[model samples]
Target: MLIAQLTDTHIRRPGSLAYGVVDTAIFLEAAVAHLLALDPRPDAVIVTGDLTDFDDPQEHARFRQITAALPMPVFPIPGNHDSSAGLLAAFPEIAGRCAGGRVNYVVEDLPLRIVMLDSTVHGRPHGTLGAEGLDFLDRALGAAPGTPALVCAHHPPFLTGIRHMDVQNLFDAAALEAVLRRHPQVLAYTCGHVHRAVTTTFAGLAATIAPAPAHSVSLALDPAAPPTFHMEPPSLSLHRFAEGRLVTHRSFIGAFPGPFPFFGPDGRAIAG
Candidate 1:
């Protein structure tokens, strides 16, 4: 099974731009096209979060309109920039799967089970999976112990070196780790909100932060660096489940140079 991960879309209303600079909508459109063009298209798309610049109904609607192009299922969770109610309202189909107004649910039809969690803290930039969310995750993973599962959320449970973004990371990570440690079936913990692609290990499990299809958070390792973004090449994560392992690949968006041959027509190595 192949699952495409798209995060931090930050879509806005039709005429607006995110942060007065990025036309996130256009970026997402390109991303949609890129996904559609994939030779073996993803079986499903999991959007980690930040689906809108603002948690506005119109913004959510716009996000929906743009992603509706994908024929596969698109699962989303609430990020700091998004609200649970907003997401539920926009994608009512998922409403029945969630409870207590939190956008937490499971995708069971696929070979790799997906447990999407809500880490958004209302009106705040940071994230946390509180006791309730932790319990939900524990229960979800425990329900199917033999299934290989991937856990997803909006905020990363671990810190990235980017100071500003780190401050807003999932605060209750230790608690989250404790829960995940008990569930050996979890293959990885994936998230977004940092606006960059990052990989690390949490509780001995593969953890990744999917890059956005729009602007990327400036890569500043210094503790004093200010929060900023760059119009870097947008990208998405493709997770392929095979041979009892989950492998992730970063697929950049947009056109680039040609795929030139590495050898001559006679099958001889082409020397530079």
Candidate 2:
């Protein structure tokens, strides 16, 4: 299965840019167009979080303008910048009304179960998967024991070594790790929060964070260093699973200003 992961779009409403700088609406349009142009279209799209800059109702309305109709289903979870109520109010179909429209949800795509967890605490900059979210995850995993599942959220369960970002990571990863250990069927854990393409291992499973679709966080590991942004090409990740193994590829859209041949001199084309 080819699952496309898009995160940290930080899409801003028309005339409402972020930090008086980024034009998220324009970038988001480019990103969505890029995703739709993929050759072997992804079976589904999982948007990890930060769908909007300020989680405003108007922003959600603007988001709908860009994503209202796509070839594949788009699933989303709330980030620290999102409002659960506002998100549901916009994408009521995928938000799935459960426990009073909680953003945490689960979907079984046969042989693969996706557990979308909620980490937003409303008005908090950092994220955490608390008791209720953990319980929901436990039950979701228990539903299909033999299937290889992916636990997805907006916050990484472990530190990313960026000290300032680490301080705001999931507060109960240790507790969540205990639960994950019991469920060996889980293939990996994925998230997006630091606005960069990052990979690490957490709780014995591969963890991946996709790059943002607009900009990148500066490669600064020191806590005292001021945070910075770069025009580095924004990207997304595609996870392909077969034969019980998972491989992830990061694709930077609207990048690489070059023109190559669809077919090589040997009359064989390379697949991107």
Candidate 3:
């Protein structure tokens, strides 16, 4: 199964720009086109939060309008920039699957089970999977012990060395690790919010933070560096499950160079 992950879209009102700069809607449109053009299109798309710049109903409406072109199922969670109410209102179908007023649910129809968790805390930049959310995840993973699973949330559960972003990362990471450690079926834990592509390990499983299809958080490793973003090449994560393993690749957006041949027409190696 192949799954595409889009995160931190930060969509705003019809013509407003994010932070007075990025036209996030345009970026998202390009991303949609990129996904549609994939040779073997993804079976599903999991959006790991920040569907809007402000948790406004109009912003959410805009998000829905842009994503309507996608034929595959699109699953989304709430990020720090989003609210549970806002997300639920935008995607009413999700409301039936959610419980305890959180957008925590599992996708069971595919070979790779997906457990999407809501880590957003109202009026807060950081994230946490409260006791309720943790319990929900534990139950979800435990239900399918033999299935390879992928856990997704908005805030990355680990630090990324980007000081400003790190401060707003998942706050209850240790608790989350404890829950995940008990579930060996989990293939990996993926998230967004940092707006950069990052990989690491958590609870003995691969963990990733997908880059946004818009601006990227400036790669400032200094502890005193201020929070900033750059108009870097936007990208998204593609997770393919094959041969009992799940692999992720960063698929960058936009056009680049040509697909030049690596060898002559005679089928021999071409020397530089």
Candidate 4:
């Protein structure tokens, strides 16, 4: 199965730009087009978080409009900028699962189970999986002990070295990791907040932070450099599950200058 992960869309109102510069809505539109154009189209798209820039109703409506046009199903989880009430209001189909007023839930419609964890802290910029959240995870993982699963959360559970973004890293990392460790079936912890295509490990398994379809967060490793965004090439991640293994590939959003043949005219290997 091919699953495309688009993160940190940060879409604002139709004509508005996020951060007064990046037109995030346009970025996301292009991203969906790119995903649809892939040789083998994605089975579904899981938007990890930051679906809107300000959690505005207009933004959410626009998000719905864009996604509703897609051929495949798209599942969205709230980010720091999102509100559970706002998200549910925008997509009523999920009201049942989010009835308790939390956005976390499990999706078993696909061959692989998707455990979407709501990491948004109400009115806060950072994330935490409190005692209640942790208990929910334990129960979810326990129920699907042998099923291949992907734990999708907005904030990554590990320090990403990007000092500015690190301060907002998952507050209950230790607890979250412990819960994940008990679930041997979890293939990885997928996240988005950092807005960089990062690979790290949590509970001895793959943990990935998908790149944004909008601006990418600058990869400044210096502690003094504050977190910032740049108009770098937009990108997304493709999580391919085959034969009981999940392989992730990072793909950029725009057209490149090539489809350059890898072989010579005479059928010999092309040399660098």
Residue 127's lDDT within candidate 2 is 80
Model 1 C-alpha lDDT per residue in residues 45-146, reported as the tens digit of each score: 999989998889999998899889999999998888889998999999989899999998999989999999999899999998899899999999999999
Question: Model 2: which residue pairs collide?
Answer: none
**Over 4 Å off, model 4:** 264-266, 270-272
Worst 10 residues of 4 by lDDT: 91-100
The sequence of per-residue lDDT tens digits that candidate 4 reaches over residues 1-272 is: 99999989998987787778998888878997898799899998898888988899999998888887679888888899988788888878776775478787888899899888888898887898788778888998899788899899898888888988889878999999889888899998899998889998888999999988888889899899976888888899999999889999999998899999999889999887
Global CA lDDT of candidate 2, please?
0.83
TM-score of each model, in listed order: 0.98, 0.93, 0.98, 0.96
Per-residue alpha-carbon lDDT of model 2 for 1-272, expressed as tens digits? 78888888888868877877788888888888888888888888898888998888888888778976567888888888896777887787865545655688886754577898888878897887788888888888888898899889998888777877888888889988988988999989999988888998998999998888887878788878776777778788899878987788998888566677888778889666
Scored by CA lDDT, what does every candidate get? 0.93, 0.83, 0.94, 0.87
Best-first order by lDDT: 3, 1, 4, 2
lDDT of 3 by residue, 1-272 (tens): 89999999999997799999999999999999999999899999999999998899999999999999999999999998899999999999888789777999998879899999999999899999999999999999888899999999999888899989888999999999999999998999999999999999998999999998999999999999989999999999999999889999999998879678899988998886
C-alpha root-mean-square deviation, each candidate: 1.0, 2.8, 1.0, 1.5
lDDT of 3 at 75: 94
